[model samples]
Target: MTPRLALADMAATVSSEDLSNLQLLLKAPSKDAVRDVCLQSHRAPSRRLAEATAATLGVPVSQAAELVRSLHVLSHHVLFYNLSSPEQILALFPESFHSSLKNLITKILLENSPTWRTEAVSDQISLPQLKDLDWRVDMVTGSDSVSRMSVPTCLVQLQMEDPCPTAGGESVSTVTVELSRESLDTILDGLGRIRDQLSVVAGK
Candidate 1:
């Protein structure tokens, strides 16, 4: 499936050390062990899960915990990238990882993808969102021909809603920000870079 997340550029963010830890971790846990650890990650506290994982994998608690963390980081990155199938995961991770490690990573990500997607949706719905955006252009014109010149500016008003607001607080907030031509051009340039990055990631 195509990726749903805007991809906070996870491919660049995940480190070589993280992948190495995950590779080592794959050799330690059986498929069933990995399934249980993934389930426990959603339910248990960090320390408890680490201890349980340590005992299950017969590794030191710190090492086990680190492995679990690495697994999670990689899993989320996989999910965010929407690399659902083994082929897609391999495509993204090939050369760096061997076949077996890639297979296991794919399996773990598949097992956890559904729940992660649900949680991501719920998280997004709970946050503030922009309801409407209104904007206008204004010009400053000098009075006489001797001083006749025009400067233009844009004013933007945003209507935002907090789906879950603090007690006794307003659910909707109005904010206005001003953007000069230069600042607007800078913002547009930044947006262009982001668009190009997405296109590259999507193989467009």
Candidate 2:
């Protein structure tokens, strides 16, 4: 049978027993390492194998999807977050790719934050603003091709207190910054240029 057909059949016939087998296969080591066992069983397509394997292991598809996406986010963090220079980060992609990359990063950051659900306080902060200044990213990866390419997004919230006094004589203020990949790049670039210019002046 064709690999795709074989995969379809495996998906259709998946059972507790199949799941058990897959679990055992996964236990051996990494997902790639278990490929031989999966291939020998029926030579299913990788996508089919992932679904079937996930089913067997009792992992819900949604949870599996999230896990897969997380890995992508992690990759971006590793690749760009620690760069020693703005030029270095910019060099990773062509100028044309920058806009899309920034957009993706922004969307990922926004999607991950729980504050997105909160109503904006006009005089205080909006969801995007909160996201801007304080958020954390988490990543996950899985065995499927889709999961490999998927970006899992989530946010860690930061707490801020208002120091301005309100009518009740209590401090009242809110702040947030919704950060996207593009916004982050813009912010970074501004800071870098300022530093560089400062250095040039100081040397004169």
Candidate 3:
């Protein structure tokens, strides 16, 4: 199965903690909680929510800075929504977080597409980690780029980049990623942990 399909399967089996954390992170009003969510979300991007959380909790700007740093560390492995097509990825996240989802989709498309040498000289190639989502784009000359884009729950845009370029004076041939329900579940589980952590911060 494709990674996205696997993720969908895993998302189906989310635990109470995952659901609770997700809700709390999205709705809570604590700066620390917001920061925790941001960090856990894998730097997935929730600008509006982050700002609101910071304001509600009266968190100092310096503390917010530190929180952002912590979030970076947490997000390293988090599956950003932008790693696939926006329409497909948004379907996976809760509808309430559509804004965040859109941002995630954009991020993946713009930032995550891979770059590599193409068959044509002076040509480059890139592919986003769209996983199981069906997508088609007209091939272009010079640089052939494909991306797996997504919209994250945090209303952030994200895209994974994987490029396959031809030898010389050619175009990128193909690019793909394996997907499975189990793997997607694991990724969601990790994201849930971040949600839980954010809830804790919000409690304070």
The Cα local distance difference test for each model comes to 0.70, 0.39, 0.40
**Candidate ordering by TM-score (highest first):** 1, 3, 2
**lDDT at residue 122 of model 3 (Cα atoms):** 23
Per-residue alpha-carbon lDDT of candidate 3 for residues 1-204, written as tens digits (9 for 90 to 100): 222222322123323333233333343454445544453434234555456545654665444444443333223312322234445534435655447533543344334322201112122234445333343332233323333233112212233334553345333224443333465577779989999999999999
Q: Highest lDDT, which number? A: 1
Candidate 1's residue-wise lDDT over 61-104, tens digit each? 88777776766666667766666677776665648687775676
Better of 1 and 3 by lDDT: 1
Screening candidate 1 with a backbone cut-off below 3 angstroms (N, C-alpha, C), the clashing residue pairs are none
Looking at model 1, report the run of 10 residues with the lowest lDDT sum.
5-14
Comparing 2 with 3 on TM-score, the higher-scoring candidate is 3
Query: For every model shown, what is its TM-score relative to the native structure?
Result: 0.52, 0.21, 0.22
lDDT rank order: 1, 3, 2
lDDT tens digits by residue: candidate 2, 97-178: 4353434433333333222112111223223222123566544455466753445444435444443345675343344444
